[model samples]
Target: MKSILFRFLLLYFALQVIPLDIHYYADVFSLPGSHLGYRGLFVLAHYTPRFFGSTPSFADWLVVAALALIGSFVWQRRQPQPDWDRWRYWVTAIVRYRLAIGLLAYGFIKLYPLQAPFPSLSNLNTPYGDFTRWKLFGMSLGIVPSYESFLGGVEIVAALLLLYRKTASIGALVIVFFTGNVFMSNLAYEGGEYVYSAYLVSLALFVLSYDAYRLFSLLVLRQPTAPNTWRLALSRPYLRWGAKAAVILVFVILYGVSAQRGYRHDPYQVPGGKGIVTGFYNVSLFRIGRDTLPYSAMDSIRWTNVVFERWPTISIAANRAAHIDASNTEAITAVSNLDKTYESQGTNGRSYYDYSFDTASHVLRLTNKDPRLGYDTLTLRYDRPDSTRIVLSGLSPSHDSLYVVLDRVDKKYLLEEAAHSGRNNHQLKL
Candidate 1:
């Protein structure tokens, strides 16, 4: 237990818990961007010979590795292997507590269907080839929200189990099996959670080692095994109560409240609507420059159809070549829900825009959601002649004079209908 390897492992965990997730923490407390200034901290992190990259995980890992290497060397000369039973006990307590916190956060997000939200109209209408494997995985999960919730339930159960010493082994086992699968899935799908997921798996494996021999003797050899009855006791009353209070406050109150608010207000995944009425609209007329192009299949430049989402997004299906943001890397807490240009992400079939409307002025402002080109804006005058008809006319971003009219269509999607009315219900129509 006092081996160099054990000390090194402990040091790694210590380093990992240093709270380097600046962006996540900033977003969590709704702190101003300047508060967690990357520019200011750049020097300290750079001394990890560091990188203040977009994702702070890599930077944190680098810093920890550097510190661990130095720490191990210093400890090697000083203690030469000191009695560390007390340290181990406390470390184990910290690991289990931290593990519980991580699982709960992830579990709640999935439980509320916020991690992989229901498919947006834009996503359903998009070409299959357009989505990266990771995006496809998320959309596939989104299709079966019940299954997503089931996965979350499993995580939550594991978290609850970890809170009790008797059940900590079982909890660790669950985490290993579950997070192991998660790690593999992330690798297979090119998902962004690989590092963090693997990090949890490592912690779980360490916790499982406590009961590994007992389990092996009992289950594998069919031998009588004695359970570990040694209980952890705190020497100081304040320390014991303080630790418990801190865990509840940070893990329960802070993370729980944040996740709940996110589920209701600004979930990571797209919710039912944004800011516009969602529907498929037929492009009744198209005018560009002095040429009024008829609705001809061969006219690639003319839009065939348009889709307006309840969100602040619109999609136009045209043969015109569109730039797509195909990178599979994921960024979290970078923008608000209203500003999430989701329709344009991992989509190739149509041109999408994040739009805002001034109802009083009868004007619509649109910004093309192509991250590659920087958002391009278009200001147009709009009129709703009736409940089903919408007309828009103005100069396009290209400086070309244009006009377009849209007719609303009654469209039903199988997935959503299945959700509104239970799939097993006989009376429900597809």
Candidate 2:
């Protein structure tokens, strides 16, 4: 039983450390994608809850717990051999050296300035955005304040400690604590996706347990070195070859699977096509009913049905309609005698608002705003090409009815239009 357990432990390590398509198991377990090699397993463990739910699936926990129990039982059943030298060498090289290297590599990767492409680092506030608006966080630690640099520093320090065997135990403990924090954070806020931090934690825990055992046996037992002269087998050429082969095989498998799935070469590109805009534009007009009340009191009157409009020619009409909506309340009112104005501006002979219709979605968005409204976003949508018209549900505060038809060819043109439209250069007053 002892021999079988020892062999099983060795085989488990070989399987885990060897680069293979063992990641297929992660897919079965519903793990997220990872860039790092076997470290992906730990990432999967951290992120499992995102796909599975807040709680781990019973099967996942059961499998891990079972493996741990079996391994523990096997380890305990082994007879105590007084091969002190052999044990020490194995503990130092296999447990300490491997762990130190792994941690250092992980730290280096995190510290690598080229990691700007990562989503977490790119949009730091997005994660917090899930819980609350980013503005509520007070400090920009998670977003713009460079928290990635801070975390990288922590990893570097921990890695350095682990490399020095004397401080390895302490280093391992610190890593565990740090990684544990990351795991908890990922679980709590990351929607259960196994993040890179979780992988670091698992590696730390494994190293910690292995190193602690050796520390206990060496110091507490006061064992003298024995004559077991087995050198560390890690540096053997065959092992290096095997590790390389494993990595290549895993990559091949992953690539093949990805290809079969029809994964995109780049998923970030806008769908349909570039330089195309599409979506609905709802244009709502407010009119006064048979009432002599103020414009504010006209709020009780329901807005008119949204009018569908189009771009370029139709966009000009929509802007004119928006201006009328803002200014014509008195015209519809029975008592108010105030008159309203509407204007528009464009470049050359083109309308200020033009469409770059997206072929895929058949959507058009206004590219330019009327200069009279100053700088503002004006979006419009067309359901179909033949649909002759677009709709406007609302206008941004920058929009004005009086200057909708002014052409601002340059800054000077803009200022002249502003002045002519009865708006002060500093303030856009209707």
Candidate 3:
């Protein structure tokens, strides 16, 4: 029974260690020797096999588990069982490092509040009902940066503990609880990363099993528990410490530096800097092909509210269908204005556009960020007569002549107000 269980676990986790995703190899080999920095390392650390899809899928797990089961049976039948203690140590070591890398990859992003970025102007003005459950979960975390950081800190701490042999069990315990909660939250919120979270939880549980007997004997039975005395014998001193040191240098130090740089300069989710005009504007006047249209909630063609984000992004609200970019994972490396789709992901009732500003000509060339509406492009000439008013003349998505008058609302958000005045003592004026 022991030999069968060992063989199964060995084969199962070996499948995990292998990069089944074709894109993983593409990313690995495509990096230029000169540009092989911490960014590349960070990307490598976060990799999960995507044979099924980009995100970890249940089908992928089932397939891998089946294959591992088949391979384990073959191995058991073909060869005599090796030293169980020695083999288990090596397997545990591999699992520990793998889990540590995955956790740290996510941990660093959240520690700096990059995973769930602060809501943009459009996000702020958007109706709560317009956001999907997953987006809502992320936005809720994004609003409280400190709490997000705390969660990241927990993951990082657990990951650090996993790096050492002595505290592997403790780290596994932390991950089982912490990542288990995350998995549950994903299910409850209809989040996309439930499979990945469950993957981590499974790894944690495996690691925790090493000390489960001792813990049960000590805590549940109120009996003295013996510490695990078995340790892997190393042929060389360098192999024992040198390999561990290298892993730490790469995953912890290098990845951390890269994450810090990302947080300061290029936040993965939120675009950096403010646009020429950044604010929520109420669409006071709307014209479609010289036809003056009054604002109506049911009118799909009439503009309602327009939001110019801090970046070169615009969101125009209308009674129109939106192609929601419901991406599962947040550990994205691409930071282009178009690629920064978190602002539009899982959002509806508004059309998001990535625009280029021609300061000399006062022309704003807008391209729809949604892949579904990628062909929807508009050229708008803007005139800012005052600080609070912006008038735009352009062709609508329908290729009709359009004109819009935008009146900026100096809306004071409670989140911002609460930052200055204590949340408990803030006065409500809205």
Candidate 4:
């Protein structure tokens, strides 16, 4: 009876992991854009558009549950349930590899700080109230790359331990506790990985059940417990050790190295500065159609303040009423940074633009970044008087000849200051 039930549970988890996790197979190879690994991720991104609000939405879960039931019903129950010990070794091997693969994929991403990158220059400039709860949580982790690395290290430790017979239970237990928190965090932060995280948690629990009764008696009820998890002899030692060696080589060393390369060159998160300077500037002077305009709160035709991101984005604050996007789901795969839409927070109240600078021509060709609205293109010639001042002259989005002077504000962020300070008897100054 126990064996039959366990078999059904195993099948259920297999379905869950096989369909949802692209990383199961993608992390095994190195990448450029055309590489097999990148292709796999690309395919999954398009095919598996995460459910509107939740991954594996209620309808998805219902489909998988129904399949598990039908599979269980057709398993020939009248033939009598087999002894659990006879197949426990095979069951454990399946769980070990599955957990190892999943954990290693997540571990390497975090290990390199690509999963939650350091907050970009734009994020720093944005108002705190404008950020979504999920963005806030993610940016909080992004600040301390070291902490993210530690989290990755923990997952990798579990993956390594799960590869062995004696330590598999311990690894499963770690996943249960660690991923349980991850699932809960996703819930609290309005994150999108809740279903996948919960699936891992469930798989870990199933694996732990092998030793659950023994652990309960040993620790909880304080009774003697026997270790009866039977195993096959090491007769095919070459085949067994060879397989283990290959897994370590490919998943641990090769995959780790490849992931690090991706992190260095094309990290999967919102970029920090896109090689541009970031700052808040005062629009000290504004002219429309060759006529100088006084700075007024109600003047939409004149710029007042602007924030330049380290990324490819900038925002101009004026008397404009902008539309803000309120969605919180994070996209893991992207064709462009704009697709992820992380920089859109607090943008609705301002005119947000993404720009490409031509250093040779001193030109700024700006395009409206907001999807809800469009504006005429703005083309301007720019000159830096010094590191602290910029001058622009060109055509406005309204097709008027324009001139502006921007003075960089001397600014300091509390978060950056906190990160730089030591946690001793030192006082924190804002």
**Ranking of all candidate structures by their lDDT, best first:** 3, 1, 4, 2
Candidate 2 lDDT score at position 19? 29
Q: With candidate 3 superimposed using the best TM-score fit, by how many Å does residue 37's alpha carbon deviate from the native?
A: 5.7
**Winner by lDDT:** 3
Instruction: Specify the highest-TM-score model's number.
Output: 3
User: Candidate 2 or 3, higher lDDT?
Assistant: 3
Model 3 Cα displacement at 314 (Å)?
Answer: 1.0
lDDT of 3 by residue, 97-188 (tens): 99998999888888988889878888888899889899999989998888999998999999999989899999999999899999999999
**Predictions in order: lDDT:** 0.72, 0.37, 0.84, 0.71
Candidate 1 lDDT over residue span 1-430, tens digit each: 3476778777777656445546544434564454232212211222111136544356667677777778877888898866577666667777887788778767766776767778888787777887878788888888888899899889988987887678999999999999999999989987767777877887788778889999999999999999988765666768766876776666556566666666776655452345646688999899988988898755678988888887777888877766666545433343443346544666676887778888899888888767666777889898989899889999976689989999998888888888877755745553
The alpha-carbon deviation from the true structure for residue 29 of candidate 3, after best TM-score superposition, in angstroms, is 4.0
Backbone clashes in candidate 1 total: 6
- TM-score of each model, paired residue for residue: 0.84, 0.38, 0.93, 0.81
Ranking by TM-score: 3, 1, 4, 2
- Candidate 1: 10-residue stretch with minimal lDDT: 41-50
Alpha-carbon runs more than 4 Å astray in model 2: 1-59, 68-142, 156-171, 184-202, 213-430
**Cα lDDT of model 4 by residue, 1-430, tens digit:** 5655666675565565454544433432333455534223323322221323334554666666667667766764644565556455665676677777778878887888877777755567666776778778888888888899999999999989888878878899999999999999989987777776776777688778878888899999999898855777776879878888988887788778867877776565553337256788989999889699998978877887888876777778777766666555444455455554555652344666777788999999877767666534678899998999999998876688889999999888877777777443245432
Off-target runs (Cα >4 Å) in candidate 3 are 21-23, 30-39, 422-430
RMSD of 4: 4.9
